[model samples]
Target: MTHHNDGVTTMPPTAAAAQAHRRTLLKAGLFGAASMAAGLRAPAVRAQAKRFAGVTINGAAFQHSFHAALKSWLPELEDKTGLKVNFELQSFPIYNQRMDLELSTHGSAYDFCNIGTPYAGRWITSGWMTQLDEFAHNANLTAADWEPGDFARGPLAILSDANGHIFGFPWVAGAIVMGIARSDLLEKAKLPIPATLDELVQTCLRTNAPGKTYAFVNDQLHHWEWPPYLMNEGGTIFRQPPTDLMPMLNTPQAIKAAEIYTQLLSSKCAPPGVLSYTDDQSQRMQLAGRANIRTASIDWLVPLAKLKDSKVRSTVRYAPLPKGPGGSFPGVNANGFGIPVGAKNKEAAWTFIQWALSKASFERMALQKAYVTVPRRSIIATPQFKEAMTINGQDVGQLYIDTVDAPGVSDYMKYRNMAVFPQVGEKINIAISQIISGQANAKTALDQAESAAIADIRKAGVKL
Candidate 1:
């Protein structure tokens, strides 16, 4: 018998191994007929119960929250669906590289994967993912609570193509473009919440104290961090459809956004060496009270409310990114559950996906603060969810949701990490680095990047 990604192969299982597997399932309350008697919705369970009993569903997900949720909820999935799930989790960078390799070469290894929206375009174009339109509407398979409409539109739109081929179901619908601040610092400084981009910059400058605390920090290397500011200023990295994308990185709005973004470091408002900070490093500064404002994912900061060793644990507050000159458009990012085209146990994989993303399961994770930006409306409306988003006794879940669902809020994935986008972004990242390092001004750096980006895109000759 060959050992596959899911650990189950075509060869027959030995009696002892089979018996052990059954005992494990039985312990999880997945025994045939007995599960129905336990008051677990029999109708829903009966139709698919043990239908893929001996099947092993392999899964791959990112290491942080997604993997955490999987580890905490896999037992429930096994008990409910009677499908053995074997999951592999890797750190962010490693997972991105590995998943790309697996999808491009060894798609059969994992039945399904938790795919970030940014990579959706790459996977879809490769013809590596199965279209799930029929599986979702199949009444016999989908649970009653799995309403497609329940997903926030921002997330749903990103997961689908122009023709509305939904390649995946949203699992993490978060606005990584929101702002979080230290409430205590703001109060002590006698400053009010910033309502616009200029005000945010001013707030950062005013609150900053050299060698003691800085006012702002963001993950600048990822490239997408520029969107919240750029889009809000009515600028974009590119214009027109992806296939015919025209680089607009050096436009008036873009230059202004870039000037302001890099100014934080140049003006000494952000900590020194901010150019080297990743998402974790940026947030660590805030957690340690070395910075007063952070423009990043709210999902990353919500768990800090419970961190015992953190200085700002009880003082942190969630806020929408300040409105820009044109308007306020926070950038929303998402991750979804996708089935590989070569998955042998796709049916079993779908079953596990349904169970894992169900309302009950989501609520369980929400109580544990596993996710702050929930995908489902039912989970968002729950009291437990409200509690999870509470800061200083204020339930701010609605604020976070509104930010994520805001109009014109750029869905980073909707741009679809096309082959060209990454190329364009790489140039822009270099340009940003040059500006931040004081080696070039915004216009000069971006002008060079823009020309190079256009050339690269044209060279790719990607057709829509």
Candidate 2:
């Protein structure tokens, strides 16, 4: 065996190598309680060992709970599934660019990869995704412990097409967009927990004490960051499903949402330099007690709940995002595993997916708090996970559930589901940048965005 510096190890395709792999795994402490559970059923898997033996599957590195599992659990995983995986971690943008080229050329560079749910539709439509119906239906390929029905319906739906061709296994179920507030600040300001965006802003403004404290903070660095506000107010970057797709961002509803968003930033209720903050910085300020409220992805709450040095550890509270006049809407996004159409080792890939997402695996990972949102209901309902998901003794699962089930929540990939996402998303980002920089009003910026989006769609040969 030759160990490669790029996180890969090359081994001869022989029984001896397989035995050595098992030995390496045991030394790495892969046989924990979880592996014991997996071990009991290892014999059943051996019945199909020939299918995956000597085959190497490749996957991109994703910043997900699955990543934690991939790093520490693969030996046990390979032990049971008889497949070797080369895990490559990279930024999503760079990974996606490389994947696009590979997928476009039908290259078999990776047998398995992680893909955002928003791009599920585009990949399936482009014939780059392997429809998973057959693999899922195979008993040898699926474990009874991995119940398909246990997965949350919303996430499963988005990862599949209208005809029910699933593109991949749901790997990451992020919490719906929600707000985390400093409970102490809300009490100090004598403000009720806000239920609308306007109320949220007002609460922030009232609670804000200038240099002593800040009121609100959000990540505005990405174009998708503000769509929760837009959707809550009956605005959309594109028309909703079952309707013809077109840009509706320049409308009155969107302009109003943009105005409110900018006002919250410019009013100094939030800290300075918020326009450049990403998810980490935005959440850090609130956890550090620099801000009273932070609106963001639900997943952030998990780390906040566990942070040892967090100033607001006991004071953080989770709730659905504040509503707009139209209603409360949040953003929902998903990350998961997909098999490429060109994959040479799809059987091994399928085997890997099954083992990785099995009920036993999910339960073990959840116990470690590896992922805040496990897509499966059974896993989240487990006593271990229920206890782990609490904040300051409050079971915040209901907040996550309600936000996920909320009607009209923006699917984080709105325009990205179409093939023109790269171009259109960039334009949308530019438009919001103009608004944040005071170079253009909402109407003018969104108008330009709308035109750019249309042109991109036309260039892609996609008819609305």
| Best-fitting candidate, scored by TM-score | 1
Question: On residues 51-104, what C-alpha lDDT tens digit does candidate 1 reach at each position?
Answer: 765567788888877567767767766665567789888887788788888889
Which parts of model 2 have CA positions greater than 4 angstroms off?
1-51, 63-65, 240-243, 405-416
Q: Tens-digit lDDT track for model 2 on 214-245?
A: 78777764455577788778887678542456
Candidate 1: residue pairs that collide: none
Best by lDDT: 1
TM-score of predicted structure 1: 0.84
Shift in Å, residue 254, candidate 1: 0.5
TM-score of predicted structure 2: 0.84
Candidate 1: lDDT over CA atoms? 0.74
